[model samples]
Target: MPCRKERDERRSYGGGNQAQQYYQQSQGAGGQKPPPQAPPPQNGAGMEGKFDDVKPKFNDVIFALLFLAQLGAFIAISVISLRALPASEGSVGLGQSGGTATTLNASTAWLLAIISGTALVLSILLLVLVRLFTKIILELCLLLAVAMSIGYAVYMWVERYWSGAIIFTIFAVISILAYPGMRRRIPFSKALLLFVIRVAKFHPSVYVIALIGTTLTAAYSAYWAISVVAIYQKWSPNAEGASTSGGTPSSGAVIGLMVFAVFNLYYTTQFLTNLFLTTEAGIFGAFYYGGRDAKKVAWGAFKRASTYSFGSIAFGSLLVALLDLLRAFFQILQSYESGQGDIIGAAVACVAQCCVGCIAWAVEYLNRYAYIEISLYGKAYIPAAKDTWNLLRDRGITALINDCLVGNIWTFGSYAVGGLSSLFAFVTVKASNPSYIQGNSGLVACITFYAFAIGFFICHSLGYAGLSSGVSTVFVALAHDPEVLAERDPQLFETIRRTYPHVLNPV
Candidate 1:
């Protein structure tokens, strides 16, 4: 927490003196400031046409190298696993097809690709729709979330889960009560969302980047899935005589390989997702800070994200990936314990998993804001994260409203996209009735579930990477320099002021 004076200084946002004070305060102990950067736009200035050269220095290069090394190791393992697959190209129980057990094969991989591709298209389409009907989607998602919360609370209470029931009931009640106050912020949220959309319309590369990310994610998902299957086939203890060396892979070795492989998958996927988001944030941050050249800024940001700031993005991704790995581990432990009927052990694992999951969520949430700073200033991850923490504290109300209202829009929008994609996959698979899964309702359902999971994550990465980056950039920019918005676009400033009158000051 800040001292009272610091807090007061942060809260008082209007006027040149206050702004200067806040800026100076941000410089901290040594009074050092960020490098000279883009100038604010003039009133009514458009964000189109040529862009200028703006280069940034490399930050957190070590982490970028580490990520590359990790990728190399994973690739080596994948290659080995692929080679081993031919020896044990057999299948265990998956599902029955034509009265025989279905097996993993090239056809299975192709089907997975098709399903994931369907999700890719559906995710992109739904993202567009969400941009168009932001308010409606937001409202509907909120209603659904609230209803689910209440229903879950009731179920938990009936099941005699006192802690879960109490927690969820509180969440439900608070949501219901907060809705009235939150409702007023909807217009402001909509306006901000539209502003980002308008900027994206000017820069089509925004969507292009998202497309690249979604494609890479989908492709990687297929590759990882196949690699996992190959590992299991080659290394399973049951594959005694099938191994190329005529020796079975020990159970411990199999587990180790799988664990590392899964960790690499999580880490690589996370790095790609954050890379997309940081790049998007760089573009938006450049625009927000009044870079005259939209094209140059967009490309420049992209270059920096993939080069100079790559390590910082990797560093952030590593943290989240590690947490995710831990959470997964705990979940597995919980499942094992529950299956063993060790109630106390299962509860402990459950709590640990929940704690780790929450921490992971918080880290990722912080990274969203931190990436704005990183994208704009090229600061290393630690400093960027610290700056974001202060920004949240100083602008708590705006952050809250943005998270509660605007954030939920992208989140629930992704869910909607995933659901649609899952339906599309189910219908397509049923209609085609492919040989690998013919007459296998269980197999079809399994495919549908994978589709939903992949669709949800890919949509989240793609959708959130672009629009949500815009939102966070806007928030950070406004907090850093509202005067720019006020001077450059007085009309927008006043419109925001109407709903968030204290935006000029502090809410």
Candidate 2:
């Protein structure tokens, strides 16, 4: 009913009043003013732009193709090899002689088969029964043994034929590809190629070592074969008074030696390959997971392993030397009783003991240190001091020592018993034949003591290395907590876990 301009004014005033009322209501609800209205979202142009820059850098298709090609090639080769081997050859075969023949001795084959089969079945059946610690221990031991054996073989091969293009090629390729950050400047493919070429150049040196190791191993194998034959000849009714015909070994003996040589070669080659691969893989894994900064950790682990192995060898050699010296002293005393031979036998015995001791100690030390370093750091070096030290202190040194004491009491105790038993045997043998005391008795006693020492060395070195490596590997695995340590030490976390349970759990 109002005039047109007055009506417009009234409408404006009414709109203002309505807005005021709404605001008042909102404030009354919680003493807060209404929030400002948000602007409508724009198109995701920023996200798209960022992705555009990244897309060209990665060729997912190429990566997938390469991975598939490698996998396929491996599968194809494995299948072809498996098929090529005759079923009989793959399995065990009876020799021409009445005695059974197998890839391993009959006893060994049966024992391994039974043990492996039982373990597999039990693992499935009693999956919940076995402790995690136990499983880890078993896996670790197996892994260490395998790795050591592989490393030894590879080292021997590399030492022999390292100068060759093929050897250098493999080594270089592995070093580049398996080591991370190394491929950033050079494409992975090119780096691998360069590595191969470098390794090839070292084949001559590698071949020399391999040749020497093979020859020595072959001689040892021959000795082992001859010893078996001698024992058989002594024990077998059919072999009575049967000396090696015309100074030529029997066909069976020759075959035995050949088998030993073949086994030694295969084991040595496989071990060396494993060692090289494992070292490279450890570094690669660490670098990949820990980014550019983990190179030191990888190198540390490698060096530590090398150091431990060398140390063990050195220690074993020293012990052997000491025993040899004692043998020499006894030999001299014996020669004096005989009044025939001079000091030559004593001197020879001392020199032989020293040489053997040195070799054994060196090998033992190397084996031990290698096992420890690998088990503790998952490589050789750990950058995170707290993490590394904690792991070593808690799991490696502490847990391993505890486990060793518990696990190896039997091993050490058995050796002690054996030594005492041997002493008793020597005394009994001497008592039975008082005549043995006249001239060569001292020499015989020295020989017996040396034999005991050798046996003890073998048992302890092999046993402890196997046990400690296995246990430490498991503890490292169990201690891995990605949420806690992964951001800083992801490589350590991942690799420490992947060392295969069999290596740790030797049981």
Best by TM-score: 1
lDDT on C-alpha atoms for all candidate structures: 0.68, 0.33
Candidate 2: list runs displaced more than 4 Å.
Answer: 1-359, 371-415, 427-466, 471-507
Q: Measured by TM-score, how close is model 2 to the native structure?
A: 0.26
Candidate 2 lDDT for residue 503: 23
RMSD of each: 8.5, 26.2
Q: Across residues 1-507, which tens digit of lDDT does each residue of candidate 2 receive?
A: 335763343233221222222222323322344334311122322122221221111112332343335335433432332232232232232222233232222222222223222222222222122122332333333333334334434643654533333543564455435334322322222222222222223222222222233333333333333333343332222333233232332557444443443333233322332233223323322322232323233343334323432232222223333444444445455555447555676566556556666665454334333333332333322222234355454434333333332233223322443343334435544554323233554444443453344333323322232222333333333333222223333343334324322222211
User: Candidate 2: global Cα-lDDT?
Assistant: 0.33
TM-score for candidate 1, residues paired by index: 0.76
Top candidate when judged by lDDT against the true structure: 1
Per model, state how many residue pairs clash.
1, 87
